[model samples]
Target: MRLAPDRRTLLLGLGAAGLAPRVLAQPRFVVPPLAPLRMEVDRITKITVCVRPFRAAGPRLDVERVAGKRVVHNYGHGGSGWSLSWGSAQIAAGKALEGGVKEVAVIGCGAIGLTTALTLLRAGAKVTIYAKDRAPYTRSARATGTWSPDSRVADAAKVDAAFPALYEQMARTSYAAFQTLLGLPGEPVAWTDRYTLFDGPDPGVTFPQRPTTVPDIRFFGVPLRNLAPHWNDLEPSQHPFPVARARHGTSMQFNVAELAHLLTSDFLLEGGRIETRTFNTPADLGRLKERVVVNCTGYGARALWRDETVIPVRGQITWLAPQPEVRYGLYYRHVNVLPRPDGIVVQYGGDSEMWGYGSEDETPDLAEAEASIRTIAPLFEAPKA
Candidate 1:
């Protein structure tokens, strides 16, 4: 559901993120005290790695013919696969059904695949999803479960002229679709507050820039800037955080474990069918009876379609046991701590944006994960009376 915070009490976030934090000119509203978090390495529950399918040119959303079948491609969303699923699916679904085909095949059942299948089913198309495994077993489940629409989405200098508008439409469309899924059985998608604990007063100052030799990470225009409701400074007296400065903000996040189950139930309840199948090459898709196919294979497309453009940007999350009392997230020392229904995610992006660029290795580094937890441990210290 939308986060439970008064809209009027919250300051406009655009100013906090874009411009300098406003100095308080008036009396601030009362902020109820929150429970302290229990954080430590022993609380660790799991550690998983996900290699983002980053393409400097952005996602491939075009149609092509493969073995006499009209294959509509909808993969390569970098780290935004879960964030932009619905909008990207809408675009791919429309292309697959352009000839008014009533039957369709969807390859891969990750976030993008499941969403595309559901979109087609809603459009009066009988759909069958063929995949090696569903969302729970895929990389999407290992996501940090946050709304990062522009996280390595594209390189600003490399994208074509039309990509900016297309990216904007996709980001906004996916954002609107997410709003409809709120207040459902499970908080499959919801909002939460985030704090930036800073040693310095300015939260605008960012991590050191990556060198020119490495690939660039694009920080695109935030399409939902105005819609984000919360951004303000939490006075030191109102809270017990042990930091010199803190900036509070809010944004949408996903609990993919619950979301995967919810989407699967909805797809099956709507009379859609799923098959456990594998494809080695484009020719293998011809065996399927459906003439139209949507390829949502994600990073698997790199080997399956032999696409060299699908660069793998490795990401890993260190999960701490869930603490129901903790409903928010925070950032300190370039390490992120996001609490979700599944678990509390701890991740560290090294000195700059090139933390995981062009890396295909999926092995989780135990040392790196532990280091991230140690980085944010100070924030959870009990406040002295």
Candidate 2:
């Protein structure tokens, strides 16, 4: 999306609030059409951020002994499904590859399943995806496409043994793969700077922290009172709020709808087969061939596989009119103000928690959405009074 001088300048300039004025003269963003979704120009003065908690889905797939056939489990990626899918799928598929299988059944059609299927196809194997829902309907499309890791991947110890190393290797690989997609035909992948404002004493809390094993996770930690040349330090005159401290960093954002459609097109072009089928029970999977089965079902792993550990950290995002001028994103405390092409998605992640995560029988709560917008309205720079 193309940003106006005021929005772009304010964002980049604010990021360097403590720096010299000469630095502000540099052009920050190249004006581009808001395309595809057809967003319009608007001034945003505040934003919100939230913790999109991630949990495992259902019981772990019994790879040890699954009806005497090779099995690889690749589900349970919460909010990080699209972010971590490709890398995780590679590791899971590699495990399945050891059995010399030429055909595989991939369950789930979101980014994870799609990436897994693509990985298998590249590895000289025929792939078929079984799922209850496809792309736009899948949870993957609902994500705010940012390249931050560990947001929804399970905790370190909770993951399987082979998963750790595989997760690391796949994360690096996936990051590199996405780097290739940077500024593609659709500008599918792009970079944005975000500011996290901190006010008051240091209770010491942070977002989407990665488990002990993940690598290359970038974060800027600063004291609540420290003032420096960059975003961490703010002069008394530049302080946006009565804040004791704040932090800032570069973040990667992807257009989920465009990226998903691009991947789906690629999948079909490669002759990949997709079967729309939903499984109510593990036995329901018996209908498929006796070959390797890779489960990519996000929340469905619970009921279908009877996973009691799976929990739903319900998030509600309000789609307000788009603000094409707001190219950069803003995060303060737990609420994030993400500017998407479709609309401005204001999300609240911590207010409510639900159990049956995989259940598609859920509906959006409009009241929750309005309440969240109200809570984070103060963060926008030019919000409507």
Candidate 3:
């Protein structure tokens, strides 16, 4: 005979008895005001190109002994250099400090290099960055500057089993680091609304009815779609887009110019030094007086160390005159429209995410820019109901 049901047992019995059906409240979404995009092609101010250092095996963060000095590799972030800069720098700086070195040398002055130098300085180490080019002039400045931590970060097949968890850690670390810069004088980093538009049911959208075993060798350790916090699905009537579906989320968009200035200033103020010099080979690193060297050379790492795995993923952006009225970003028809403090950036996402792989062509195509503008201009032409 069973004893009288306890509260816990009674709840289990009630659930098994189907006494009540679980009901969840449907979320009420608010529709934002429709703002027409300013897409005048004639107002285009500038065009810039950047090459992302994509490594199929993911970023190289291992330590090596070179010329009797400790060399910490911290490059090869692919499209995520801007997104993962701080976190990756932290890892590199920690490794550099493993032996408790008092001084550190950072090669390259892009996002990764500057952050690494700053990180070392914060940790009570004398830091110096040696590079041919600096921020605002480096490839990092040309980035679209969105918080996309896993965008082509690695090829799943090439990464190890532990990479996803590690990637998550770095992504979270970088996110937290960027938060400290928000609302500062230059507004280096700020939250902005991003809308992913769909003409119909987006072919890119996938709904897994059941969990399928994903192979370990994938570009992302975890899918980027699952990482963003303020992501929401909206009905056509609940969004400002003319499209059938719009995925809305809030992301930290960096004003590259202001961010570079801020990072450079912060690094200098913290006693970090910058040396404008170029290195042709890994052997050149030995010339530096510091016993520990952190390599943040980005794509230059491909040639400096002769690493064949580094691939160039070229990206171009067309800037239109500043449009203060435009506060949101939109990705539609493989075109990205991002409004920032400096200018409005319009870029092509290409047929696939890896469309420009291995291409170093920096030349900006005006015809291509015009075509991208035409594709999304119609959305603004439609009258808001």
- Per-candidate TM-score against the hidden true structure: 0.87, 0.70, 0.86
lDDT of 1 by residue, 1-385 (tens): 2233343324444346655454433344444566666668899898889889988888999999999999999999988898889989999999999968999999989999999999999999999999998868988878888888888777777888998888877888888988988888769988988888877322232333323336456644445666567678877765567777788888898888988888888999999999999999999999999999999999999999999888888888989999888888888888888888878888887766667778877887877777777677656653422
Residue-level lDDT of model 2, residues 255-289, one tens digit each, is 87788888778877897888889888776666788
How accurate locally is residue 247 in candidate 1, as Cα lDDT from 0 to 100? 83
Candidate 1: misplaced stretches above 4 Å?
1-27, 200-223, 382-385
Cα shift from native, residue 102, model 3 (Å): 0.6
What does the lDDT come to for candidate 3?
A: 0.82
Candidate 3's displacement at residue 134, Å, is 0.4
Count residue pairs with overlapping backbones in model 2.
Answer: 16
Evaluation by TM-score, superior candidate among 1 and 2: 1
Score candidate 1 by TM-score against the native: 0.87
